[model samples]
Target: MLQASDITYTYNGGLKLVFPNISCPTGQHWLLLGQSGSGKTTLLHLLAGLRTPTTGSVSIGGTDISKLRASRLDKFRGKNIGIVFQEPHFMRALNVEENLALTQSLSGQKVDKKKIHTLLDRLNIAHKLKSDTSALSQGEKQRVAIARALINDPVLILADEPTSALDDKNTREVISLLEEQATAAGATLLVVTHDNRLREQFPNQITL
Candidate 1:
């Protein structure tokens, strides 16, 4: 459901990063492996429609997002491309459910409290629904982040360094949750990270 081809980016200093082509089918999980400074983040941003590649195209369901105008791109991304950042960013004043409600609202989607609650329940963070984000444990907060990402039922899920700080067990758990949720939503999942241990977890991978 996701395809990125001949991707390249160039900075003002003339530094250029070229990425390997990636094609992930519907409901599949893929690990994008690379070391530090390997442009993994850059490629992730491109795939998420957050950054326009200097060359090539990124498509989901045959829609070449590189050609989308800014407004259209933002709208399309919010509706179809869900991103999980390495660190959780929350509105301190808002409770867990409130935060997720805001995500749906920002996406131009109706606030579906039932959907938000169901997602948190699945991620085991439903107990924190009314708790301030600051009051939650780091792990709980991370799970909330996952819940927010899946709330939109995006067509493609792009997770950047989702497991960089976790231990082996948590890493495995988080990866499984991502895959399970993606499958449930009928979305393609692509995790971009520098972690080598993931090489053993995903059957399909492309290294930068």
Candidate 2:
């Protein structure tokens, strides 16, 4: 479960963003919709512990991540939170398998090759395991991103602008894939997107 309350972030030059309180329970899927400059990505970063809010706390599974030291926060986020950025930034020198393996190692977990393969298989990206990430098509890369995000069996999955560049068919497929994988992992899912096409897809939604 995830809880964020009294969230306000201020950037330099006096830009301020105040986010609504969020309380998402385990296994639920929620969508966060906002227009450009609405701080959707900023809010996602706060919830994912990638950034600290200026005025609030974010709790995942009862731990106040904002209070964690950097080292501990890094390890905890790696293990408990899976983030799918709009751009999948894989290390250029690493193949899909190596990239995913690095994620496991970074989380202080043993590299589970079986887990890697199974996740790739489920995402239909098994054929790309040894392939360089740059060689993948857009959809393939997105699937691989999903595979990487699920490789650690994170308790919460945060996807930012996941379907912004996709057509209707691929958008639906990606959303379905995320939902299916999250359900299987027993993880709460939060998607931050500006796309109006997804408005009707999630009944539990927050619009900024």
Candidate 3:
């Protein structure tokens, strides 16, 4: 469902990072492994179309994202990709459900309350629906982010250091949740992290 061919990126004016060609089929799970500064997150951002690569192409479901206009790219990303970042970011003023509702609204899709509830229930955070984001604990907030990412039922799921803050139990729980949802939706899953503990969980790994 996603492909990155001969991708190269540079930052800080001179530093360059090159990645091997990577492709992910629907219902497949991939782990991007690298240390800090090794460009794992950069690769995830490139695949998500959040940042364009300096060279090469990224395509999702057969369309070349690099050639898309900025407006069209944004719309395409909203419809096709879901990303969970290392840090959970939310509108502090909004409750958890409101935050998700706003995301669906912006995506030009109606909110699917049943799906939202099911996602939260699966992540064990259904009770936080009425709570303000500020009141959630770190783990609860992360689960909320996962719920938001899955709310769109995106075709591709990209997670950057999603297990960074969790203990072993929570890490396993979150990983399992991501894999389960992605498989159910027939979505391609790519998780970027330095955590080798995840290796046993995801056998299809790309080491940078």
Candidate 4:
């Protein structure tokens, strides 16, 4: 479902961050592991098309996203890719459901209330649908973040350092939730992190 080849990135007046080619098929779960400076985040950003690679191409479902124009790429990402960052971000003024509705609308999708409710229900956060984001506990917040990422039923889900802030129990729960949701949605799940504890749990792994 996703592929990257010959990837390299460079910051202004700095060294290049090179990455190995990555390929993941549909409905598969993958772990991307690397040390702190190993370009894992850079690689994830390139795969998500958040940063255009200095070299090589990223392909999703056979489309070469590297060749797409910025506007088109943004739309394409909105419709096809879902990302979970290390720190979950939400509009403080918006309630949980409103934030989800806003995300769908930003992607040019009309609000799918049924979809939103179903996603939150699956994440066990249906009760928080009308609550302010600041009111959620950490685990609840993470679950909500996962819900937001999956709100669009994206074909590919990319998570960066998702387990970094959690305890072993929460870490396991989050990872399990991500895998389950990806399977349920028929989307590819790729998590990039320095958390070695995840190594034993995932069967498919790539190191940078």
lDDT of 3 at 48: 84
lDDT of each: 0.90, 0.93, 0.89, 0.93
What TM-score would candidate 4 get against the native?
0.98
lDDT of 2: 0.93
Q: Which parts of model 1 have CA positions greater than 4 angstroms off?
A: none
For every model shown, what is its TM-score relative to the native structure? 0.97, 0.98, 0.95, 0.98
lDDT ranking from best candidate downward? 2, 4, 1, 3
Q: After superposition, how far is residue 66 of candidate 4 from its true place, in Å?
A: 0.4
Put down candidate 1 lDDT per residue, 99-196, tens digits, no spaces. 99998998899999999988899998888899999998878978999988889889999999999989898889998999889888999999999998
- Model 1 C-alpha lDDT versus the unseen true structure: 0.90
Which portions of model 2 show Cα errors greater than 4 Å?
none
Q: Write candidate 2's Cα lDDT for 122-203 as tens digits.
A: 9988999999999999999999999888888899999999998889999999999999999999999999999999888899
Model 1, residue 41: what's the lDDT?
Answer: 88
**Residue 23, candidate 4: alpha-carbon lDDT:** 92
Shift in Å, residue 45, candidate 3 = 1.0
Minimum summed lDDT over a 10-residue window in model 4 is located at: 11-20
Clashes of each: 0, 0, 0, 0
**Candidate no. 2 TM-score:** 0.98
Question: What ranges in model 4 sit over 4 Å off?
Answer: none
